[model samples]
Target: MTTGAIIFMIIAMVTVWGGLAAAIVNLVRHPEASEAEPSPPVEL
Candidate 1:
């Protein structure tokens, strides 16, 4: 594989793993820890 391809693959893998970690962390946190309210639906 070319140098550029290897670099791109590494970045993509890191991004995917980071997203997964964030999701799991969010799920394991207490409900009271959430402070943001859901936004209202937009009328497109």
Candidate 2:
């Protein structure tokens, strides 16, 4: 309702959605290798 509240809401929305967008872009640019083998377990 208030102007300050609206501004804060927008900032929060951008923070959340912006982080998601950045993560997606990063994943797309550096995708995981599906055919990669898992590392062998180390002996204790």
How do the predictions measure up, each by TM-score? 0.62, 0.74
Candidate 1, residues 1-44, lDDT tens digits: the string is 99999999999999999999998888888454435777689998
- Give residue 10's error in model 1 in angstroms: 0.4
Superposed on all Cα atoms, the candidates' RMSDs to the truth, in angstroms, are 5.9, 3.7
lDDT of residue 33 for candidate 1: 44
lDDT value, candidate 2, whole model: 0.97
For model 2, what is the alpha-carbon lDDT of residue 26? 97
In candidate 1, which residue pairs get closer than 3 Å at backbone N, Cα or C atoms, i.e. clash?
none
**Top candidate, metric TM-score:** 2
Of candidate 1, the 10-residue stretch with the lowest lDDT total is 30-39
lDDT of 2 at 38: 88
Give the clash count for model 1: 0
